[model samples]
Target: MVAITEMTNWAVDLIDVRKTYGKAIQALRGVNIQVGRGEIFGLLGPNGAGKSTLVKIMMTVVRPTQALGTILGRPLGHRGKLAATGYLPENHSFPGYLTGAKLLDYYAALSKVPRSVRGPRAGELLERLGLSRWGSTRIDKYSKGMLQRLGIAQALMNEPELVVLDEPTDGLDPVGRRDVRNLLLDLKQRGNTVFLNSHLLSELEMVCDRVSILVNGLVARQGTLSELTERTVEYEITCVSDVASLAGKLLRLGATVAGPVVTLPGHDIAKVNEAVDCLRSANVAIHAITPKRVGLEDILVEAMGGQDAKPSATPPTSPPAARPAGPHGDS
Candidate 1:
């Protein structure tokens, strides 16, 4: 294991990290990633693309069979640093016999929370996560959303500097998802580092400062959403005339058209002009043209070698809101 010097800066840094499972399953391939303190970083990828493996390596839940990395300025798997970090795995189950309060107490003790502060802290977190009424309920009785909240409460018991959450909103109803988003914002305001691994791209786009996308066991793309997608511009144009016939022509000319609109995919000025010329030549009078901001989901799909097709229905979109809504997330 290589030693880490100066633990005062980055909360997490990966230097050529690699992981392989069994004979041919290379879960991670020579990946290099870095996350600064107090930043919300998202690890995104398709199913089976190593997002979970990478997170497990970071939390020391599974040792990387190859390569190296550091967390909280200590080499990966360092026990001392692990104590200062909290982790919520994708599929977590607490002991069925224990009440929510007891489960938290047990984990807090393991986390070395002071004996005098554990009770109050547990109560505070229960209240904060909307679990106060169910403190005495056994884990077996808790609903999926409640269990998820309890999982988070347990992770925060020690007030760790780095919090890693995988699929944090899975199974959560709209309102429940909104709550988690709000909690993440509060954590950021308090200057804590949040590393999220999720398939929920909308949530990631709203909360993350930077994101890394993995493909075929390697980091295919990583950066701020704006940075990875900065060069791609999509515009939704609506015209009074039914221009559906022109879609095939626009696509052949390097544009994507869906239903009532045609979209130019890149930021090249010439391409935009070319589309305009094509439309004009076809005598298609434009009714409206609005820039369609690319999102984290859009970039991840494209990076994963997936096609950018128009969705079943045009998704209802509002300009980015200042704060993301809770579990019943405005759905």
Candidate 2:
């Protein structure tokens, strides 16, 4: 059952969403997510974490057991709002007989974009996505990277306010991935909301303004990259001279010594300074000192390991307050 609430400024707001596949298999436990307008929000998780199930529910492709929220300021599955949104599924299949331009035209038409606008829009999107030369080429003749690019172009044909993409760079090479990253930033600049579902941690880290990590059908962590990685995990000091002889003394100071490196666990600046002083007094040649923080991969691994154990660093703070709508109007 879904309860329609008053319209909101959020591009996507889901609350207590749940789904059950059979009599016993629970695909999604209670899950809640909020995406601000005009931001690139990334969804991440290991396989079987219900990431796809949540996205399908948002797109109305799968019925939820219980849900409440708004998408684009209207109730879920609202036709007008649906028309204003675009989606690219995980393994989308398009007709092989259609040319690249034709496919874009078809998708745009389905989105109710005016016939007069489709042609110019198709051409512009093809060029923007590096498919101008392949506009007239049959999709069957396109390479995997080209097909992926075409799929992205199709998703933007309507100039949608909200674009939901699942694995947008699934088949692209490094350069292609970089291009997609740039394109996502461009969309944010145009005040468009993007909900990205992908397994590529480094890519998400670079592009996403905020992210949510789902583990075992629940959101284990959700926040901006800086908020999530605010705590310094450790400090590493690299020295030109071997420090293996000082292992016992360094260990006594809550640091570990290996070869020419001295590692101080946790965010203790005083301890790090003490180690540095010790090395300096010993006439050790220090090369560099670096502080390390937990990244997205580290967060994901910790989430998957469950919250029972003590985390290596402080947990992320709560998500920030709702942001105002962008220039594109209420999301």
Candidate 3:
């Protein structure tokens, strides 16, 4: 298992970050999180769960009541370090008049990218994000998928050491989502770190190496994918024949069977071995044996105690508008 080690090289290390609104609304409660270098980290929670508020603090867009930690090895809210970072916030709005290509250049400039590199950087980002053909088209005419791609390109313009994304796949269809997944994987391969927050649990499952689930202004759960899914990880066993007698024996052992298939619903390797021995003893034809992992949504649902709406201790308040580290086009 590849993991970002707990060390001084942590890309993000925010400890006891607390935020409150007015007199009683607590948005964050001692939120402590650590992200490793060159890893795709996913943060998850329902609406008004301080997910947005936490990310805003990272970009220094919203001041936390109290936060003591380091980001990219610098103190929290260190502006000089932000120049090397890329950010794509949720509900990001771009200038409607600018073409897709121009949009990238504008955001890049905000990151303080040199003039010599902006043009080439913008072109390369457009092409990589599959927006090369539509570079000349205005954003007002672009589709939802196109706009999402443009937002990603804008974040990458500076070739940042670390990138922060919030709900990056908000409006994308399946095919477009696949493309985004591929792009994220490519970024990881290039040794850049990604810190992601999204409501789409499946998308996070596909790309995140580690995840933290924040519920009611606190981190309810946090770990690697395998660690998070440890409780419900399952294995499957398949046999070629639908032998009735063997089915009964396996059934008594609590295995689910469906015509030549037996599903052992636990992570125990021994049970799998026991099932295999039973099949062999019964002279049943053995077909295949494999493991099936649980989904992140299931874990999240369990973590939140099966709640459907925002599980907040306080009433909802308007969150800050999503904005990049620099002038992210228009508000």
Candidate 4:
């Protein structure tokens, strides 16, 4: 178990959280997670890893067998703090009879937002989410992607300081996903803390400031992306000439040769230099030398004990956008 340390700067602090069903099915063993204020934190795990259960516990939607911590600096289940928080649950079911605008107003009212504040906020969020033209359209008339967008808009109706989203981009296409990523960044710019739970590792890699990997209800790993991937740094050298001939020499220098490429694990520059020198001595032409850090998918695979667990479908790549720097200056 990872030791839990109390920190006052956290927007969400969870300690020793556990949940069980019918005394036999342990959904969560013991989990500790901390999210800094004004940052985007991601929660990722394989199916039945208690990701949704944990989120529900945080949102006061499901009762936990044991839990201790604070949300927004207040004790668990604090009414005022909960009112200040926003949440969008997984597989949400909204009333289809209500129009998009009416739905936002209804949700905001439930959060105790003033009637006057609800209208303007609803309009602003509708426009922000690209639903201005569909404001009066009934939710049943909206597409799956549009409903997902409306769900996110309703969560922000109260202008929460801490937003907990479960699969916010589940039904979104490439463009919709890109828009959601931008919206998340905009929330961070406004000093809002976001706790994101999703199965899409690529999307999380693009936006999360830090992440926690859970396995069988336990936290297998947790930290900033840099912290988690630091040990996974490796260098790949592609050669025009066959690398088989130099395998024996490169092996002595802690490098593996396969076909026309040499793989060197770790960040040892001297080893790479020696390998290059060995290849040069053999008159092998070098095509490219690339450095890489293992991605979130790689980390998740390792956490799952090398099992062949598939994450959600990866969306098409889009142009990179400017992102906020994480604690380690990487995002």
Candidate 5:
């Protein structure tokens, strides 16, 4: 039996979900993920990490070897439930012969959108997506960015409660990306759930309420952005004069000297003062001192077992105050 959590309206609730391809290519290995209602959740990983497979399973495009969960509070693969869900797959293809407006109308019809509402909704979405002038133009002539925006519009054509996008911003420039980000926030404000799969960590960091980093078909880490990132805080101090010579003295003050930059634990204000005092005593030129926050990318790289992660001077503490009470998360 699936465990019922406090989040009764979970957008996604899966337990020990597993998928395998052929006999040896295991795409997912009993993974667990829960996305809350109306949340902008992100899934990130390098290529071949089963991110796409996960999405496909959710969309019922791929049948999992084993899955025990509910989507939108309904049994997985319930066709009727799909009307309330929207999906924008990676590299989406639209009919080249149809005009942008007709394209949306066609999809709306497929979703059984009311004929009366389809026309106005299509126009509204085109205007909202900055494609109002191109509505009459054939999709074949639309640029890659335009096509991407249209893909989002088509996904929204049915006013779905849950929107799943795989690399939604794959072809957009900076401005286009910003527009999509703003649009995502707007959707969140409207109380729609968004499940995003993207390789762009920075973009996810900017918009996601929570994220999961999947590696080798397993979820390495998953939690709220702040919960995953705020592990250790360090204060950075830059000194140009004889930093190498003062390394020993700085170490004595609970500071680590990395070239001319000295990092002191953020919790220790006394060490910061002591570092300054020592620098002043040695006639050192202090350039800057700032808190060095742990970013999401840093944590992800560390989770991926990359070599760039810096070792903490202090021993690690208990894992972040138990990811905010809600549906179960990756342990």
Candidate 6:
């Protein structure tokens, strides 16, 4: 295990982390990620990727058998840091017989919250998370949204600096999803770092300060949403005049003209100017020029695969099917 003192930053850091299940089952391969304090970092990958494995390691639910990393400035699995870090697993299984208040109290104890402060804090969390009314209800009766809220409350019981959430809004309705998104924003405002492991590209795009995308157990890309997907679209110059002559000229200049629009692709200023010069010389009447911007999902698809990209027309209320299973399995 690496020493916690090795890292200068007190934020989360994973250096050359690797994990494997058996001789052939490799879960992570040289995975490295760094997140600054008070930043929302997103872990993105298709099903069967190593996002969950990384989160599990961070939470100490499963030890990294081969690789080493640290969380909240302490070596991962360091008991001292566990109290300062909170985790919400993707599939949580709390004692169904316990009331919401009791469940949170149990977690508070496990997190080593002072006995005197535990009860009051539990009540405060229940009220803040919109579960005060249901605090007396048994966990077995709680709806999915209610349970998710309680899960968040439990994770926040220790006033942790790093909150790791896996699919926080997986089964939520539109309103519920929005509420959880707002909760994440609230956490950010309070200067807490959220390490969110989710496949919901749109949601991550909305909230994440930075994102790391993994493929085949390796980090394919990592950066802020803007840096990863930033690109200038092909300038669309719509004209009203006949483009037959103009098309020929554009083709000679290595440009493509279709119908009334001439596509000046690439981000080369000189190339765009040359194409514009050719069009102007042909007496083409330019009616409109539009530069389309690519969305985060667009860039994700380009980097990962077309199959993982969510259809734009599909409503957010209905999430798309899981990404097709890769060789290792669905993440």
Top candidate when judged by TM-score against the true structure: 2
303: Cα error in model 5, Å:
1.7
Candidate 5 runs further than 4 Å off: 1-7, 239-248, 254-260, 265-270, 280-288, 310-331
TM-score of each: 0.81, 0.89, 0.83, 0.87, 0.85, 0.81
User: Mind giving the per-residue lDDT tens digits that candidate 2 earns over 1-331?
Assistant: 2234444668998888999998787888999999999999999999999999999999999999988888887778998988989898888888999999999999999989999999999999999999999999999999999999999999899899999999999999999999999999999999999999999988898899999999989999999988987767777777777998888879998988889978888887778777877877787867667666777888898889955333343222322233221111110
C-alpha lDDT score of every prediction, in listed order = 0.79, 0.85, 0.80, 0.86, 0.83, 0.78
The residue-by-residue lDDT of candidate 3 on 1-331, one tens digit each, is 0122233888888889999998799999999999998999999987878999999999998999999777787877777669878889999888899999888888888888998999998889889888999999999999888999899999899998889998888899888889888988898999999999999987998899999999999998899987876453455555666856677788876788887768776666677777777887777756555555445776677678885422222111222342221111110
Query: Which pairs of residues collide in candidate 4?
Result: none
Q: Report the poorest 10 consecutive residues by lDDT, candidate 3.
A: 322-331
| Candidate 6 regions with alpha-carbon error over 4 angstroms | 1-7, 237-262, 270-290, 305-331
If ranked by lDDT, best first, what sequence of candidates would result? 4, 2, 5, 3, 1, 6
| Tens-digit lDDT string for candidate 5 (193-308) | 99999998889988999998888889999999879876546666666544888888888877788787787865466677777788777877666555445676777778889978
Count of backbone clashes for each model?
Answer: 16, 0, 0, 0, 0, 4
Model 4 per-residue lDDT at 40: 99
Error of 5 at 61 (Å): 1.2
Quote the positional error of residue 143 for candidate 1 in Å.
0.8
Compared with the true structure, what per-residue lDDT tens digits does model 1 show for residues 27-57?
8888888898999999888898888988888
For model 3 the local lDDT of residue 32 reads 96
By summed lDDT, the worst window of 10 consecutive residues in model 5 runs over 322-331
Q: Taking the tens digit of each residue's C-alpha lDDT, what string does model 6 give over 15-112?
A: 77788887778888889899988999999888888899988988877767665557776777879789998899998988999999999889989999
Candidate 6, residue 122: Cα displacement in angstroms equals: 2.7
Query: Between the candidate structures 4 and 6, which one is better when assessed by lDDT?
Result: 4
Supply candidate 5's per-residue lDDT for 283.
77
lDDT of 2: 0.85
Comparison by TM-score, 3 against 4, better one: 4
